[model samples]
Target: MSSAFSLSSGRGRGAARLAAAALVWGLATAGTIAAAGTATADEIPQNQGGATATIGDLKTYGSAVIHENGEDSWVSAGLFEMSVENGGMLQTYGVDLHSPTQRDARYQETSWNGTSLSGNAKAGRIRWILENSYPQVNDLAALAGKAGVTGLTEQDAAAGTQVAIWRYSDGADVDAAAPQAQKLADYLEKNARDLAEPEVSLTLAPAAVSGRPGERLGPVTVHTNAGSVTVTPPTDIAAGGVRVVDQDGRAVTSATNGSRLFFDVPAEGADGSTSLTVQASTTVPVGRAFTSETHSQTQILAGSSESTVSAAASANWAAKGAITALAAQKNCAKGGVDITAANKGDAAFTFELMGDEHTVAAGVSETLTIPLQEDQVYDFTIGGADGGGKRFKGVLDCKTQGGASGIAAQTLSEPSPASVGGSDGGTDLAETGGSGLTPVIAGAAIALVLVGGAVVVLVGRKQTPPQV
Candidate 1:
C-alpha cells in the first residue's frame, strides 16, 4: 500500500518524458503479455512492446491509513482511476507506486502468471483475493450490506477492495476508514488462492521461400519457448525422395528453438510449392519486475491456461524443364549413347556435358554421343534455371541397331546432390543463412477501459515480460 496520490482525468500520449526522478514509479514483473487492438492470442507480433498506466482521480472511502514499519501513513484507502492509452479507466488498487504523486503518475505494467506466482505467496494470494472479493463478485449492494454498510458508494467499495488487495499484494497491514470496507478486507484475507498462468505462443520467421528445382530452399528457423517442435511437410516430398533437412542437409523429424530448416527439392520435381508447419505447446512460469538491475515487482493478470501454437512456412521451386539430364542410346553407332543437357525455359543454364563445361541457352539442347568400344556407365549433371544442378546416371551401349537396348534406367538422382553434400560439381546452389527473426510471446498491453461500478472489468496490453 502506498501513500495518497492523484492525477488528471484521462490518458494522453504515453511517450511522456521519463520522469526525472527514477524512484517516482515502479511496476510488478509481468508475465504472459498481450496488447489491445494489436496482437492477440490469434495473430502474432514480432516482439512484445512496452506498456504503462497512469493513475488519477483519487477517491477516499474514509481516509484509510496503512500501518507499515512501526509508522503509519495517511493514504487513500484504495480505488483510483488508472488511465491507459487506448484503454479506459479501471478502478485500480495499485501494487506499489513508491511515493505520492500529483498528476499523470504511471508505472510499467507486469503480470504474475507462473506456478509460484512470481515466487510470492502474497502475489498469488492477492490474485485469489481479486477473483473472489467484492468488485470481481460484482454484487456491490449485497456485498456492502454484508459488510454492514447501506448505500456504500462505489468509491468506498473500491477503497475496501484495495485495502484487502494490500493485505496480500503488499503484505502491509491496513486499517480501513469505512467499517464495511475493513470488514470485506478481513473476510477476503482469510481465503486467497492462486490462479494459473497462460500457455506461450510463437511464430516462424520468413514463412515463405523460393528456389530452383534442384536447390535446397531454406534454413527456416524456429522461434519459440517450447522444448521441441513437430515438423510436418507434404507426403509427396518423402515419397518422391525429397526431404526437409537441416543446415547440413541431414534429416530430422523434430526441431527445437533456433533450429534451421530446409526443403530439398529433387531435380525432377515439378515446378510447384508446398508449406510445412511446426507446432509446439508451452507454459510461461511466473513474473518479477523492475526498479533495479536485479529485482522489482510483478502482477498476475490472469492465471495461465494451456494452449497450443503453430506456424507455417512455404517452399517453391522452378520446373524440371528449366534444367534436365538425358541419356539416349544411339543404336547404329559403335555401342554408344548421346548424353545431353537441355534448357527449354527462359534462362541460360550451365552444366557438365561429357566431362566438359557447357552452357545451354534457352530453347537450346547440347548432346555428346560417344562411340565407345565397350558399354560405359556415365553420369551427367545439368544446371537449372538457377545455378543448382541435377545428376543423371545411365549405361550407354548400342547393340545390333537397338536390338537389345543396353542402357539401364536414366532419371533424376534422389536426395539431390545439393541436399546431401556438395556433389553437384561447381554448379551446386550456395547456402543462404536462415531467417533469424523470432516472434515469441510478448505484448504491450495497451489501453485502459472501465466496465462497471465496483465490477472490475479489466483491460490492458502486454509485452515480453521483462527479466529482472
Candidate 2:
C-alpha cells in the first residue's frame, strides 16, 4: 500500500513516446519548480535620490591647537553644511570633516545604513555649540569678552570657536590658539546641551514590487550607515508567518550592511505586503553623506555623530503582473496587435493599453485588436491597473526600418505541467484516474510510465508521433 502505481494502457496515437516524454518532462520541470521554491534574490531598484549637494561660503571658524606628546597643531573648524535629504536644510554643523571636501562634491552621496545608540554624548555636546554658542549665536564680541581675551581677531575668533567644538567632537583636551578662545571653548562645553541623535542613517531600496500568491520576488538589499541592526520584518496575514525571510527561508530579525533580503510568500497565500522596518544603535560610518534629487546639494555628516536610526521598506504583492506582447504585420508599414488572454487565477480584471480598457471574465478568453501605423512604432507596455484578479499583460512591436518583423506574444507565467488537465488518446479521464503526478508519487508513476513507454515506442516507430 505504501507504493501503489496504476498502469495506463498505451493503446492509441504514439502512446509509448508520450509516456517516456511525459515521465522525463514532468520530472525535469517539477525539479525546476522545486528549485525555484528556495528564495531567489534579484536586484530591486534602490530607494535613494540622485545624491547631490550645494555648499555655502567657508570662513575661518577658529582653530583647535592640540597638545599630543607636547606637540601642537592647528585644525580648522570652518564649514557648516545642511540638507535633510528631504528637500529642507536643517542648519547642520560640521563635526568631523578632516578630509578635504570639494564644495563641488555635493553629489557624491552613496552608501548609507541604519543603527541604534552608538556613541556617548560627545557628538551631541559639540552640536550644542552650533545651537547655543558663538558662531551659532553670531556674537563674537560678546564671546571674546566672556572668554576674557583681548584682540580676538576675526580669524582667532573663528579658530577659537572651532577649537572648542573639536574638544567635544573629537573628545580631545585641545584648546584655541588664542588664550581667550580657550576660555570660549570652556564656556561652550560648560553650557552645551545634548540633543537627541539623528534617527535616519540608512535606506531600503525599492518602495514597491509586485508578486502573486505563489512567487518569490525581489532581492531587497539594505543600505546602511550603521555597523549593526535589528530588522522588524513586515507583518501581514497574507504570509503564514511574519518574519523577513532569508535565501534559505530563515527569519532574519537582525542583519548588517548590504544584507540581502527577499519576500517569501507561501505558494497558497493570498496577496499582501507591508513594510519592513529596522532599527540600530551604531556610529554613522565615516565619509558617508546624504544626496539630493532636485539639485547638487548635500550634507557631510559622517564619522562625527552617533544615533539610533531606523528605516522601512515595502513592496506590492499583486495577484497578477508580467504580460507578454505579440505582433503581426500586414505589410512593411502596417502592424496590428492581437491580445489573446484568459484568467481563472483570480476575479475579473481589466487591462489598460493604447488608450482603451478591455474587461475580461476571470475564467474566459478574450481577444482585442489594436492596429498600429508602423512609422517606427516600437514597444508597448499594457499596464495592469485593476487592483486584483488574473492579470493579463500584452506586449507587441513592429519595425519597418530594416525589413519584415512581427510581434510575438508570450505568457509571462504559465501553469505547471502538473496542473494541466486533459483527455489522452480518446480515453475517458474519469474512468482512467488520469491526472498530474505529485512529487511524492512521481517515482512510482515513473516506473509504470517507463514500461508503458517501452511498449508504445516499439509499436509506434513507424507511425507519426502524437503531441502531448
- At residue 343, candidate 2 shows an lDDT of 39
Best by lDDT: 1
Report clashes for each candidate as comma-separated counts: 33, 32
Q: lDDT score, residue 182, model 2?
A: 69
> lDDT tens digits, residues 258-347, model 1?
898888888886665565777655432222111111111112222122334466665545563333322232322334444443444456
For model 2, residues 1-468, the per-residue Cα lDDT tens digits are 011123233222122222322332110000010001113222222223222334333334444444443333233333344332324332233432221122322332333221001243455665456555544556767667766766666556555555655555445555665566667767777877776444435655543333555555556777776776788876655456434777777878887888877766666665444556766654443334343221121233422224455555554444553321111112212233344443333455455554445666644556565453322122333332221221111111121011011110001011211211112333111101011111112222211121211111011011122333
In order of appearance, the predictions have TM-scores of 0.35, 0.34
lDDT of 1: 0.40
TM-score of 1: 0.35
